[model samples]
Target: MRILVSNDDGIFAEGILALIRAVADLGEIVVVAPDQQGSASSHGISLHRRLVPKPVDLQIQNVEAWSFSGTPVDCVKFGVTQFGEQHPFDLMLSGINEGRNLATDVLYSGTIAAAGEAALQGIPALAVSLDGPPFPFDEAAQVVRKMVDRLQFKTLDADTFLSVNIPAESVDGPWVVTRIGAEGYRDRFIRHTDDDGQAYYRYVGDVVRNIEDDDSDITVVNKGCISITPLRYRFTNEPAMDTLKTWF
Candidate 1:
C-alpha cells in the first residue's frame, strides 16, 4: 500500500524519522511535513500567507520528503490532493508526536489534525504519539512496526483511523483498546505582553484527573499501556439530543 506520511513536528524531528524508518518496508512513503514546529496547532490552515513548500534532501533514512511552511493539516491536504495523485497513496500516517494526544488534547493537536484531515479525504489514517517529552522514539517506532504487522487494514470502516499513544518507556507487549477519557488540563491560559507591547497568551495547564471514576485517555496513559482509540469524523451527542430538541 502506498502511504503518505506527515507530521506537525517538521521533517527533521527524530520521531517522524523513526516512524519513517520503521514503516519503510510497508510501501512507498511520501512525507510532506511542516517546515517548523506546528505542535498544538490543531486543524489550522494557512490562509493569509502563501504556503511555501520546498523540496528537501533529508537523506537521513532516505525517505522521500518535503517541507511546507504551513500547518500539519495543510501538509496532509496539500500532499495528498496536490502531490499524491501523481503517485496515489492508500493510507496516511501522521506523527509519532513528541507528546501524547489524549482526551481534549486531540482537539489542539496538529498531529491528530493531520490524520483527521486525511480521514476527511476518505483515506484511512493513523496518528501516533509518545507520552512524555524527551522520550525515546525508537521504542515507539518498534511498537508501530509490530502493530502494522499485525493489523488488518480491511477491518477499518470508511473514513476512520486509529489514534495511538505509547507510554514513556520501552515496552514489548500487547496494545489495549480504550476510550477517550474525560480528564482535562488545569490552570487554563496565561496572557501577557512582551517588551514591544505585543499581547501573548500561553496555554499553561497540567492534566487533572477530576472525576473519581472516569474512563479517558488521560487515565489510560497514566496506567502505562498503549492506548488505541478508533476515531471518526462524526461528533454526535445521542443522549443530549432530546435535551437539545426541547430547547428548540
Candidate 2:
C-alpha cells in the first residue's frame, strides 16, 4: 500500500511525527505538511496565493519527509496532483492531532479537512486524533500501525473518510469502531482590544462536556472507547427541505 501523510499541526508536530513513524513501514509513505501550525483552519485552501511546497530532508522515524507552506488540505491536494500521479497512493492519512475532533469540531479541524480533501479526490482516507495534551506518541503510533495494517484500503467507497478519535486513556490495544457523540463543549470566544488600540480577541474558558447523550463522542471518550465516524462532503437538508419550503 502507498500512503500519503499530512497534518494541520505542521510538519514538526509531535502528533504528525508520531503518526508518520507509526505508519511508515505500512507502505510507501510521503509527507506534505504545513511548515507551521494551521489548526482550526478547516478545509481552507490557499487560493489567492501560489502554494510553495518545499522538499525538506527530515529524518522522521528514519524516513525522508517534505514540508509545505499551506493548509493541511493543500498538502494533500499538492501530493495527489504532483507526486501521486506518478507513483500513486493507495491511501491518504492525516493527523493523530493533538486534540479530539468531535461533533461540530470537524467543521474547524484542518486535520479532518486534510483527509476530506483526499476523499474528495476518490482516495481512501483516515483522519486520526487523540484527546488532551500530547501523550506517548510512540505508543499511539503502535496502536495506529495495527489499525492501518488491518484496513482494507481497496474496498473503501468513494468520497468516504473516517474520523477516528482516541481516548486519553490507553486503549490496552486497538480501538473500536464507534459513532460520533452529541456531547461536546459549549464553545465560547471573547473579543477584546489591546492597549495600543489594536483589535484582538482571545478564546477563553475551558470546554464543557455535554455527555448526557450516550452516543456522543464525549460519552464514548469518557467510557475509554475510541470513536470512528464515517464522513463525506455532502451536507444535504433533505429532511428539512419541505419545512424550509413552507417558510418561503
Collision count for each candidate, in order: 2, 3
Runs in model 1 lying further than 4 Å from the true structure: 60-62, 191-193, 196-201, 212-215
Candidate 1, residue 179: lDDT:
79
Local lDDT at 98 for model 1: 90
lDDT of 1 by residue, 56-123 (tens): 87664546788999999999988998767777778788989998888888878999999989988878
Model 1 residue 183 CA deviation in Å: 1.3
lDDT of 1: 0.83
TM-score of each model, paired residue for residue: 0.90, 0.89
After best superposition, candidate 2 residue 84: deviation in angstroms? 0.9
Worst 10 residues of 2 by lDDT: 171-180
For candidate 2, list the clashing residue pairs, or say none: 181-216, 181-217, 182-216
Top of the candidates by TM-score = 1
Please name the candidate that would achieve the greatest lDDT relative to the true structure.
1
